[model samples]
Target: MKSITFLTAMTVAIAATGAEAKTRLLVNCFWPSSHFACSTVLPNWVEEVERVTEGRVTGIIPPKSVAPPPEQLAAIERGIADVAVMFNGFFGDAAVGPKVAMQPFVGSHDAEAMSKALWATNREYFADEIEQVHLLSQFVISPAELYSQTDTPINSLDDLAGRKMWVLPGPLAEITKKLGTGVVSGPAVQSNEIISRGVVDGHLGLDPQAVQAFQLMPYTKSTTKFSGAIYSTSFSVFANKDKWAEISPEDQEAIMSVSGEVLGAAFGRAWNEAAAMAEAAYADAGIEVVDVDPAFETALQEASAFVTEGWLKAAEAAGIDGQGALDFYKSQIGEMTN
Candidate 1:
């Protein structure tokens, strides 16, 4: 009986040691628990990591954000968080490499394509700009769809004239201004008050899936589906350099197999699927979705030139062929669609 007990104790000890050998990474999900990043993307990515590593390495998202969105990258860089996701625009110029993803008229409404294109382009050209953290996946918000409080038809370019509209900072703001519309600029969170208080006649930066998260469907009565070049926000999921270094080379290869562009493409596909749901929600909410004519599309395309030109110039200053990157991204997207 003593020898049998000794053998069982040794078996348990070996199992405990093997379990301790697994590397568990803490994934910092600053988005709300219900937010897609917390509820879906991170969770799904974590599963992939565990599966690919065969329990060699895994990750966990804390109950609350370790830091605010803008600070997520810095937090990871400082080692406060092992992994994090950041909105590239919030840090402005720091994530200049992926800014190509934000240039209007360059991509289709296909989120998966855009996400994959950005990752491919980054690997090809802008990896230097992303030196601090290990870029896991880079992506963009689906193009913005204009939502208004009334079923006012925005059929012609002239219809938007003088209307107070909420625009996110950057080229979209320029496009809104060029349309002869008044711009009310603020973050997405401010849309609720801005619309309720009549500060802006409508918000121009949210699509249907986004509206569901913001609870804007109840207040919105109309939506305008712009052409491929509308607008979008860029973001990236990354890991701390040191934390990444701590991961064994074999595990690193395993982790990245499911990360980077693969993970980015997954995020885009998920969001695009959610976009379909948002469209249904729009119908249920009685929101009118206006499809403007070809003329309006031409005008939109024309206005977007300024934004694209400026991005190109900025890209050139950053020391690479900006036009080359843009062209590559578009070509990559085309390939993905095919």
Candidate 2:
């Protein structure tokens, strides 16, 4: 028994050494190193990939991102980074899978379930729409709600009017614009500076995790939530095409075997847990949480009409089953959450 144990440990050490010798794929992460994406999601993913492959592959994140948040995809595609995370919405109408995932009221606050649904939807109906890169995993992060730092709270649809709001680009921006708010488009990472400088009166899509991650509690004092998710943020992990091609097919399968929906579900669960923490933080900060009436929901659906139509139009242009994809995604979420 002692001899057998020694041999097994030796074999494991040899495998680890072999994997450690392979060219470590550089993972360019745009989020702060303290942020969960850098600290948890990406790191955990790297470990999982290496472990599942029995140390046949490995990866690492640089000290900082090689490019800005919006330019991550371009950097990876250009081979400036081997693997990277990207906000799908950064590509606008060109990124249909993300647009589909961000559609209003399509998901609930269960980030894990929503993420799994998004992966399933992408695999079945929207993969071709975003196959421009070698996709490793696809995901979304919230059932986002409204947050404010000013005197006027966003309790009603009309309250949204004329407020200069910092919003993420993509369908959420269009949807907010239709509600009569002026939008300042930027990524969530910049929200602290924008809100502090008074660049925008409030932000439109502040999720609980975001509020906590960015220290938004000091700036924001009120919250408005919809019964269902107002909107969600889309993300993807992808490899540079050439870099992906360099991996042996066997290793590719080993890498992919533990990615996609399984990894996406992890992000969902992590975000959801972080959101719970934010809620506790909100309570300590005296942030007033408000739930809108049914009337507000009616007005929201009417106000945001073009967002879905725009997605479908873009989908048709890309030959994707736009409505079908939407239905499939929602159904998957429903199944998982239920």
Quick one: best lDDT, which candidate? 2
Overall lDDT per candidate, in order of appearance: 0.81, 0.82
Encode model 1's per-residue lDDT on 39-80: one tens digit a residue.
898899999999998988888899899998779988998888
**Most accurate candidate by TM-score:** 1
Candidate 2 Cα errors over 4 Å, as ranges: 1-23, 197-201
**Local error of candidate 1 at 49, Å?**
0.9
Q: Tell me how far the alpha carbon of residue 304 in candidate 2 is from the true structure, in angstroms, after superposition.
A: 0.7
Candidate 1 segments exceeding 4 Å error: 1-21
Scored by lDDT, model 1 comes in at 0.81
Each prediction's RMSD over C-alphas, in Å, is 2.8, 5.1
- Report clash pairs, candidate 1: 136-260
